[model samples]
Target: MASRILAISGGKGGTGKSTVAVNLAILLAENYDLVMADLDVEDPNDHILLGVQLQNEKPINIMLPFVRYDDCIKCGVCGEVCDTGAMLISPNGLPYVIPRLCSGCMSCYFACPTKAIVRGERTIGYTYETLVQLDGRSFRLVTGVLREGEEHTPPAVIAAKERALLTDGDFYLIDTSAGTSNSVATAMDGSKLVLAVTEPTPLGLHDLELILQLTSKMGIETWVIMNRSGLGPEDEHDRVVRNYGSRIVARIPYSKRIVESYVKGRPIVLLDPSSKEASMFRELASMVKEVME
Candidate 1:
């Protein structure tokens, strides 16, 4: 059977999206086979929060334009077709490729009439598959880590998601990066449901709307999770979610225990299953299980 994907995303940073994802995965794995894919290549920390090292690293390679200077035809077509300005024509009438600026779109490759652009390889990131055993059950964790100084993230995100999907599982939970970039969209593609985590602050409210809009357009069922609920007024947050035709499904109140558990690299669900935060995760897992059935 194909895996049912559930995406956990947040439009703004520091919204506890990963925390929700890790905890829910642990709870869900108890009843069903689950594979969690951490697609936040820019700053992936799901493995960190799960307290497991990433294993089985595989490099993600993309097409890097290698100009065959010997072919020697600089018609400026390569530079003109470059969308990211990665292709530059020097004063000497030669096309130079800026490795960092290239998005690997390969627009210049086909546009070059001289056929000087040859296909080369560049390593932008790596993907890892780790087996996380907690309690008596185990789930696979696929993580994507972008190479330092690499700006392109969509490739790495897609790579990680694909790696997770290859495994046989009943549920495929994806943890996306903060924000509504193409990278995030790539990570959330083909999800059965999306849980958008947000706080009550003004900044959180602002980005929550962006994520809701993206999910709405994708025609995915979305549920808002109010994290740190008592920090600020949620009148506007509630209004915005309702406007998007979605409702808040869970609320994780501010608590010092959650903070300490996070600091110690232990999820509240595992640290103290009897805690309020752990109960919230259990309730969320129940709702997700209903959807799965």
Candidate 2:
């Protein structure tokens, strides 16, 4: 079966995109094969939130420069060719390579005349996979965790996505980082559809607009899910969101029970599928299916 990759994204943090992505994948796994990937490598929380113990933690390596001191010409060629400023030429004309700023492009190594630079691998993050059982349906949860002090989230996101692509499934639910930067863009690339989760608060509205703007520019079809809906009533936020021409596929009302279940690491759908929040998610799944069909 053709895989339906759905990217869950929001421009700002604390919008519940990962919560929705994980639960939606669990819900869909009841009748279809599903693989849920947490592409937010900088702060991966899906596995923790799901209470799944990851077993296979594999290191993600990226290229770094290894200077061959014996072959060095002290020409400062590597520093000049680094586009990311990873290599710095000191006042004394000595080159210093900063591993963090390096994008693993290896351009400096290839451009060196004396072959003084050699390409080496550095561990930037780790990719993990685990099997989670939700409501008797078993599904895979894969995530990438970037090491502290690392600025490359896009590479780790790509590593997690590559692992997800290896699994054959009916659906791939990708939970992206909360931003408009390269990390979010890398996760959403090649996705068939995107679900932008937002809240009714002022900040939520602003970030939702930003996310919508970015997604529209990518030519990707998007649907919005307004969380904590009815916090203020009168559908003011709904009207404002609709003005952007994107339909609100679902609205999960603010509920203490939903929050409590999430804190307890239990799927709200399992708590009571007939509850308001659970029903809202079900409606969301149905709407997505209709669109994909």
Candidate 3:
């Protein structure tokens, strides 16, 4: 089996990237061993959509400030060495460290003259891996959850991808966050192909362009999925997208049954792969397999 990594990303939120990724993983798992990674560390929803309980969640740690006050002369060296403004020097000549602003570069601790700064660990996120069996076939699901108020999603996303790679599966489907930020880039770095999920709305087309630009810059092959295709008669957006050299591999039509089944945590493909939406997705998956082969 060949290693094939597919990253599902969109530049904007509510574009159904996770939905496409999850369903694609479930469908592909029928013929290939699948490792599905939820790299949307900021707010992972793949597990929620799959209705699978995430077990063995291990906390992911980040380096934080550990101050040694005993050896202290009130030196501001740590504050001056910090670039993120995580460390602050008080008017009274005391130094304070804000963990939130810290990037864990350890520059402050390295530059501290009094050796008063030390590295400490903070729980920035958690990662979990589980197996979901559908139709007598089991697929692996790995996800990372970044603690709210933390800003280091890129690392967590990378960690989750690394964990997924350990599954040694033939197919790896990565569900990325909704943005073209560093986190999305990190999640998409090593993908063999990327499928950008979008709706037929103006906002969806707008972000699809942004994500396409990102993928172009990265030299990654990309395809678009125009979800909710019948929501409106805006064919111009689709035309504009194709003009940019990316093709729409699938168009999932808007259906109340799809929405309700999604709310109930069921994969649309499983409900009926012969349905209009699922058939389109299957066609998309077939195209993906052809590309990989």
Candidate 4:
């Protein structure tokens, strides 16, 4: 059978998206050959949590605008068209490019009548591939890391996703950047299903609704994982999930053992496969396999 991409995402950060992704990948690999793609270019830490070094690194660059003074008109059109404020008109009326602010959408370039904008490449991030072996089961992990100063994340996310697709696997599990912004959409673009991880806090529920709205628009199946389930109000969270037509497939309480496993650079699932936490992940994986099959 051809491979499918299953995305694990959440609207807010620190909700354990990466942890769920790595553990689910580890368990799923037992039944199906898998590749895990970490698309959170902003703060990728799957390798850290998995305790594996990234291999086959590749730099990713984006197009930066080069302004030609010769063809320049003092027109404010470039600045007006720049959504990211990368292009700005100086006091003298000439537009200058701010590389960090540039999303490389080329909107300014297209909107410029003088053709003063030229495309230049800037190395913004890197993509990495490594093999992770756990309990005699191995799977490939592809991670995208954005440079510290880079503002645009979608390109890096796209680059890492493409790298994961090149590998041979029965299932490609995608760990997306937090939030329901365009970058997250880029990572979740072709996913077969999305496991949306969130907590029961006010912030968590707020962002969860936003992501659910996005996925509903995309017409993708999404299941909720109530991470840190006992931290806050569950009734409101349940109402929100019910309103979105998404079921809460799993609930993981905040546990010190989970924290210890994270600190020790080992998945809790690996620490004791027979434990309740590990069984939760295994059952989830089994449900996914059944659905996909």
Candidate 5:
């Protein structure tokens, strides 16, 4: 059978999405095989949260255009079709490529009427696979890390997700970047269920609606995981979830123990299995298992 994909996402940053993901993975792995994918790309920290180092590194490269001046007929067609302005016309009427700005769409390569554009490649990021073992139980962790200066994130997100899907497992749990952008959508694709993590703040509620909008449009069943529930009033958040036809699956209360575990690179479920936070994650994992069954 194919793996059932479950995505954890939020529209705003610092919403404890990764915190929920890693803890849930530890709990769920106890019974069923799980492959946890950290598709944030820009800053994937699931491996860090699991206290594991990434292995099996692989590069994510995209198509680059190289101008061959020898066969040049500077028709300026490449520049005209370049959406990102990666193809720049020089003072002498020759086209050159700005590597950093290139999205590797290959529009410049095909638009060159003179066939002066040659194919090249550029590495935007890398993907990694790590085996995390704790108390003799393990799950495969796939992570995507973007280069510091790279702005192209969708490709890396897609690459990492693809890598995760290739691994065999009973459940594929994805932790996406914080936003409703294309990169986040790419990670959420094919998800059986999406848990949109949010806080109780006004900013959190505002962004929660945005992510719910995307998930609703995608026709995926979404559930709200209200992190830091006691920080502020969540009456508005409750109404917003009802408006979107989704329900709150779990509410993780703010606690100093959770913070300490996170700071120490240990999941609360493992650091303090008897804690309330750990129990919440265990219950969440049970819900996921029921869905998979």
Candidate 6:
């Protein structure tokens, strides 16, 4: 059978999206084979939070344009047509490239009349794969890490997602970056469902609609997981979710146990299966199983 993907995402950061993803992955892995991928390329810390070292590193490289200075012509066309401003025409009429500014869209390469542009590669980030286990049951974790100072993240997200697909699993859970940017969309794309994690604060409520709008457009099954639920007014959050045609599937209350478990790199579900948070994850996993069925 093909893998069923569940995307854990939200527009606000610090909402415990990764925590939910990791714990839920542990719970789900017990029954269904699981591969959890962290697509938050700008700052991926799932391995850190899970307290496991990332292994099997694969480079995610982007195209960079190298100018051949020896070429006879110093046309400014490449500079003018460049979308990311990576190509620049010097005062001496020679075209040079700023590698960091490049988006690798290849517009400058096609626009160069002198054929002076040579394709080069720059490592934007890396994709890593590792195995984690709960009891005897094990699941794979694929993480995307963007190199420091890299601004473009969509390529890294795509690369990590593709690597995750290479693994065998009955289900795939993707943890996406905050906000509804192109990078988030890229990571959450093709999900069987998007389980959005959010807080009950006004900021969380405010950003909730943005992600809903994106998922609603994609026509994916959507669920809201209110992380730190009951910390603030949930009525507004519910109203916003109902307006978007999604329902609240689960709520995790604020607790110090969760904090300590996160800091200790142990999933709450594994720490205390009888705990409310652990049970909540099991409940969520059951719902996912039903959906897949």
Residue 22's lDDT within candidate 5 is 92
lDDT of 2 by residue, 1-293 (tens): 24588899975758888778877877778757888899888888888778788868899999999888788778988888898999988887677888989889889889989988888999999998888886689988888899999987878888999998787777888899997787888888888899998888778877887887888888888888888778755265567567667788887888898788789988788776788788778878877777655
Each candidate structure's TM-score, on Cα atoms with residue i matched to residue i, is 0.98, 0.93, 0.92, 0.92, 0.97, 0.96
Report the number of the highest-lDDT candidate.
Answer: 1
Q: How accurate is candidate 2 locally (lDDT)?
A: 0.83
User: Which window of 10 residues has the lowest lDDT sum in candidate 4?
Assistant: 1-10
Instruction: Please write out the lDDT profile of model 5 over residues 1-293, one tens digit for every residue.
Output: 25588999985769999999999888888987889999999888999888898999999999988988998888888889988888898878899899999999998888788788899999999999999998777999999999999989998998999999999888899999998999999899899999999999999999999999999999999999999989999999999999999999998999899999999999999999999889889889999889877
Which residue pairs in candidate 3 have backbone atoms (N, alpha carbon, C) closer than 3 angstroms, thus clashing?
A: none
- List runs of model 5 lying over 4 Å from the truth: none
Comparing 1 and 5 by lDDT, which wins?
1
Give residue 244's lDDT in candidate 4 (0 to 100).
87
Q: Model 1 RMSD to the real structure?
A: 1.1
Question: Which lDDT values do the candidates have, in the order given?
Answer: 0.92, 0.83, 0.83, 0.89, 0.91, 0.87
Q: Write the per-residue lDDT of candidate 4 for residues 244-285, one digit (tens) a residue.
A: 899999999888878888999999999867778888889899
Q: Candidate 6: RMSD over Cα atoms?
A: 1.5
lDDT of 6 by residue, 130-172 (tens): 9986577788999999899988888889899999988988889
